[model samples]
Target: MPSLRNYDLFISHAWKYNEEYYALENLLSSADMFKYRNYSVPIHDPVIDPNTKVGQEKLADLIEAQIRPVQCVLVIAGMYAAHRFWIDKEVAIAQSYNKPIIGVIPKGQLRVPESVKFAAHEMVRWNTDSIISAIRSRAL
Candidate 1:
């Protein structure tokens, strides 16, 4: 049995994309939903050796279970997602479920990760204030 929870969004991104992660999470922090317990951040499963196929499958299963209840998957698109297995896997699962997915590109010249763009249902160029506004206003 699953524990019941209420949340309107899930934030997913590659851990390598640390800057984007903090920026986007900061945006969501000001949202009323965040304060009201209507949003969540997906917890990453521990990394296992790449050569362990069974471990990889188990990790994927763990992530899928954690993300299933989320109403939307918000991706912070940074430059390295194509090289990150877990980010790709998470985006694929979210897309397969027809979960609403959005990507916010971090400021400066950071290129949008191909995996992120591929999975994004909507995309935005994030100015700092606009990112906060989008989340706070629930406009994205």
Candidate 2:
């Protein structure tokens, strides 16, 4: 890919909790986000195929292909995020690639999952302004 205008954020979250998912979508799509995000959901959530070995192989290939495009990873620290397999997998991949990881705590919640605290390079609230401000603070 050509040099990106801003960072590409690979989002990892637990399927059990979707509030943070929508929260992130709003944050990244905002005009104020400064083209500082190219947010993508985890590979397992997208383009999954169980029809045949060939189809599965293709999806695996696609996932492998996408790994390079991720510059940063946002991990949504939901209640069950720490125990989810796919969430863990995504975090591991981000860590291996040395991507900047930001863990967001969804609204109406303050307690953080241990995984988020440990895996994230930084952590923030899910509110749009707070999230944006955290990004700005981290940049500085």
Candidate 3:
């Protein structure tokens, strides 16, 4: 088989770590022949405080920087309801840069937010094969 391409990706979340986020990370890392570079801001290493207007702008800039070079943006659909603001900003950033957005519905999740549903270029399941396929076919 040919060597797999290494994709640059941005996984959107509420500026915090969650099970879905970690699961996807592990999945991608362990998948056979799949490789990726995650640009998502880790919870343990924050870029800025987002309490004030200036801070928010800085945060936005930081997020943009993370998204600018990415080929695709992976969104945790189940986390949208709770982190709509950040996720929306991430989506907007991804759109501005023409990065493909792939919404991953968490395992066993019943309902997904419309915000994510509408923004995603493609919605995928919380599985290694599905997510890898999306990145391979959809990522710019």
Candidate 4:
């Protein structure tokens, strides 16, 4: 059996919906089945201050660097994700890098973004088993 940590993953999410992101992270990290798995993000908390004005190209480059080494990209498929320009860019970068994209439908989410649906190589509901299966099955 391969450990979940064997696959490197980058999670693309909106800063405003970080609460859901943290919840997903906690679920993946604390689950008994994934206890030995290693799931990590390049940036611990990748929230840039709203007041901070960074160049779009520079930010994309920085995000690309984070996405480069990962084998998979996990996107939280909330409706708001479609509106976030950065998440779209992240998904594009992941595609450019040939990384597998996993769209995670957040618990209680009624709708998923089209961009997320289009980018996702696999879509999984918000459950440990489903998430782990998608990661293990789709990760490159």
Candidate 5:
């Protein structure tokens, strides 16, 4: 059964959605008594081209707008190394808005980057229980 409390969350990603992202989605969906709405920007539905300065600003604005209403941000620590540019911007936006960030260490990952750790309010494992617990605790 889904919980009555539905959390709004922004999961950070590069332009392309990866396996980790899908895995996280599945984990959340299958978790007992957990419900959430994802505010992630999908590649199939991009806001704008981030190449130009104007477009970058617009995209940043869009990302900020997505993060503003969310209870917390979920960052895939393994994806950060490859997409630091946009992920960094997302983290900055979340921080500026006082949104809590939950850094999710990817399944089988042993080392998470220091940057991700530093930005996160709480670090959680890939397990659904741990992740849900962190979200419930930190978002408060």
Candidate 6:
């Protein structure tokens, strides 16, 4: 069995819809089942910035740097994610790096973006067990 510490994740989220992102983070860090897990984001994670004017190639390079070291990429499957170009880019970069992409459907959400569904290697509900299982089982 792989220890929780073995999993590192890059979370892609839209700044406008940060509630799901924060909730996911809280669940991963505060849940008793995941108490021993060391899943984390980089200190200076750039995925939150949705309005950056950086060139496409430069942005991809930066995002790639963040995704390369992680075992998987977690994308919040909200409707807005489909419209965010950066989120799409992030997913593309994750794919280019051969990292597993885990789509997390936020609690109470019934519909998710098509891009998220297409990009995800696996999809899990907003529960600790499911999320952890997806990360551990599907991550590369």
- Provide the TM-score for each candidate, comma-separated: 0.70, 0.71, 0.91, 0.83, 0.89, 0.80
lDDT of prediction 6 = 0.77
* Candidate 2: residue 57 Cα off by (Å): 7.9
Root-mean-square deviation (CA) per prediction: 5.9, 5.0, 1.7, 3.3, 2.3, 3.7
The local distance difference test score of each candidate is 0.65, 0.66, 0.85, 0.79, 0.85, 0.77
Using TM-score as the measure, the top candidate is 3
The list of candidate 4 runs beyond 4 A from truth reads 1-5, 33-54
Task: Return the lDDT, model 3, position 99.
Answer: 92
Q: Is candidate 3 or candidate 6 better by lDDT?
A: 3
Model 6: lowest-lDDT 10 consecutive positions? 35-44
Q: For candidate 5, give the lDDT.
A: 0.85
Candidate 6 per-residue lDDT, tens place, 1-140, comes to: 66545467888866567777778887877755443322333344465343565555665676777778888899989889878987898898889889899999988989989999998999899889899888778867
> How do the candidates rank by TM-score, highest first?
3, 5, 4, 6, 2, 1
Worst 10 residues of 2 by lDDT: 41-50
Model 4 per-residue lDDT at 85: 88
Determine which window of 10 residues in candidate 1 has minimal summed lDDT: 33-42
Count: clashes, candidate 2:
0
lDDT tens per residue, model 3, 1-140: 77778899998877454767888888889998888999986574454667778878988888999999999999989855455687788898899888999999998898889888998999998888899999999988
Each prediction's total of clashing residue pairs, residues at least 3 apart in sequence or on different chains, is: 0, 0, 0, 1, 0, 0
